[model samples]
Target: MSICSYLWCLIISLSCVAPLSGNPAAVKEQISLKREKTITNIVNGVPTIDKKFFARINMPYRDKVCGGVVIDRWWVLTAARCVDHVSDHQYELRNVFIEIGNFTTGSQQKKTYKAKAIVIHPMYNLTTNSHDIALIKLVKRAPMFRVAELCSEPVEYGTEVGACGLGSTPARHPSPSASLHEIFLRGIFFSFASFFEIDFCPDDQVCTEPITDGASICNLDEGSPLYKLQCHSRAAECILGIASHFVASEHSEINCSGGSNFASVPHPYEWISETIVFDFLFNSGHLDRSF
Candidate 1:
């Protein structure tokens, strides 16, 4: 793929942080504070390949909090924390909606369905961030838009992976309704585990960075799925990784947003396939699961 380079504007900071305590764990030696988890106020650089595919995500919060994938006719997969921000009842799954086949700004796509129920990853914990994932249930079966295909084989070192999202561009993020959109950004990473590590799992979570296409996903890029592209394969080239958190914040005195640091997703996505997430979909009846 050709790399598109864009100069990044200064990243505005998000001001919340989770305080960590020096505690001991059953299997750890030295304990450091884990990342305090939170969601961004807006999404930037949101993009989609097909409006129909795009139509499968783009949800409505109290006012469009974020985006996700409609894996099953009944399930929309998104970050567990993203759902939590707009929900008061951690135990209840109701009053959430999503739109697909549409862009953040202008559009042309199809309709999927409204969310009737929502479910977070059973293992996800806001405190430790054990599992940072979730599933949303649509009240009805969303029309079958093509779902992303996860790789059955492991990703090779230096294997090509692609990322797309309704996330913030380096210039604009957490944009309001007027600036909100779904734009696609090709992600390139600075390192790789599959190529670099000998004991890495070949599952879904293989990490890499842009070598030339230097644009990366920002705070709003949570739960954005990374894909590998090939000219021959019709299905997903492979699952690269989810848009997780920035590592620089852990060592730097600042955050990712430029405040002391920036926001990031904790775990990389290795098994967050639409099918894996679809199992938790509350009302999945209309969609096919032959995948």
Candidate 2:
């Protein structure tokens, strides 16, 4: 997760204030979908559709719902934005429960895990989405869920990128239940994403769009992993970016039209792979004394 740089965060927090729901394309269109195995390989370079590539991170807040990528028995990747409020945490990764291996809301395929320690990027700035990545070291390793492999570069300009989450579609009024109704997401071709002037994707992130009219992100799906299609690779998943942004206007009109353009700050996993955090875990004996 990119740390919020003081300047970036301030600007983003202000972007939502002006609000842009008036644009018809920014609105969301609702369609009733029954649980169908998410169709993958529907777009180029994406892996097969046999299994879902995401996991749901349940949190206390309605809009701030977090997401996790199934890495292995002991790890999941999410955004530091989910826990940006932790100024005084010493592994204080709270409200970090993830339900993985499911297709629809309340799927039985879900497995719950507790974050043993959430290591937020040192440079993460919640305000600007700098280093907007985080790792939820699970108390117990997750099973069956395959960890999506991340791409090093911004997927080819017009690539088919996919996002999934037990996240919600916009609801102007809040639902009394905690369950988030997942949105029907597909491989969006980012062919024309500049009209909105939407800009949250930093060099560290990428989900702005050459696809999905207006090119936006969704509520609660924050911290969800982004993947590009890589059919030739045998890897179980093709992860391209991490979800991070705050641009949906929340205006009922936009939410109704079923269009919202947003972006996510991504962590070049190539960079993250060599960080001390990996070494800290390889030597598990250090957390108690290393810091």
Candidate 3:
């Protein structure tokens, strides 16, 4: 017999015998193990390692009251409502602090920075929750922390996204979670904003539904960054939006079960870039005070 023909016959014989020789229960167990390993990487209200771009916004006597993402060395992007103080006139600049590089709320290794300024969107409306975005200028540049890149592309319906924050969970009511938690959510078409008693523009907001039951962004999760993995790698996160508010549902008693909306990063991309440049110039005394 030829060498090629002999090898082909041997391969066919092994293929036929391998399945017969394999134990059914063992094969099933191996398949189950493989599935479990794959599911482990998918976020489902699980604790996450410390992310350099994740920012915890803390108020006086409160830890991680809101969440933010570092967009620049001295700037953090967040929801306008998180630091809104229209009546108080910039009170958050003094009271709010930014904590970075910490997974837990009270970690000693966390770096805290005082806020130099809190800039809310000019068109932000308290009644309708429109233009719900803001920026926080840090007192000094955040060192050793990576800046999250803002995503310009629109999130297509059914696309998977990730959200991370130190927010309230079922076990921790009336208080934020002690450690950072991440959950996977899918972009959805949410047209019934009025029915849910939430206001959002489809063009400027990204609506999402949780992939895992009982896993959602809850209280104190406002301003938490909604990101997508770049190149399917956990290390490369592209910020898509910031958590704005939860859509209340009359059918469900659970918080954030109905779904949530985020202020799209690309919607305010121009404003953000301009504001940063203007702030830098003004603070550096390059711009005329009279002008």
Q: What is the TM-score of each candidate against the true structure?
A: 0.55, 0.60, 0.73
Whole-model Cα lDDT of every candidate shown, in order? 0.41, 0.46, 0.67
RMSD of 1: 12.1
The TM-score of predicted model 1 comes to 0.55
Question: 1-291 in candidate 2: lDDT tens per residue?
Answer: 355686777665444222323352442121111111110001111222344547667655434456667654566777777765643344445555677665543447666776566567666776665677776666666664466555544433433445544433334332222332322233222322333333333355453321333223444556766665434332234566566653332333333212222233233464456443564557562232112
**What C-alpha lDDT, on a 0 to 100 scale, does residue 232 get in candidate 2?**
38
Number of the top-ranking candidate, with TM-score as the measure? 3
Off by over 4 Å in 3: 1-44, 61-64, 86-92, 104-106, 171-174, 189-201, 234-236, 249-252, 284-291
Per-residue lDDT tens digits for candidate 1, residues 1-291, read 223222221111111111223322411111112123222311223434442333223434344445455455555566665665545353333445466655545544546465554555555555543455566666667666545444444333334344556555443433333323333222222233223232212222333333232244455556555555553332245433444343222322222231111111223333444444555563344323122
256, model 1: CA deviation in Å?
6.4
lDDT of 2 at 247: 36
| Among all candidates shown, the one with the greatest lDDT | 3
Which lDDT tens digits does candidate 3 get at residues 1-291?
999999988775444221222354553333233221110011237777746788888887434378899999989999888777523334545678888886755567778888877778887775666778988888889874568888876644456778888765552253567888888776643333323333334567777665676566766788889886543354435888888876543333443444567788877888888888887767752222112
State, as a TM-score between 0 and 1, how close model 2 is to the true structure.
0.60
Candidate 3's C-alpha lDDT?
Answer: 0.67
The Cα error of candidate 1 at residue 228, in Å, is: 2.1
Residue 43 accuracy (lDDT) in model 1: 28
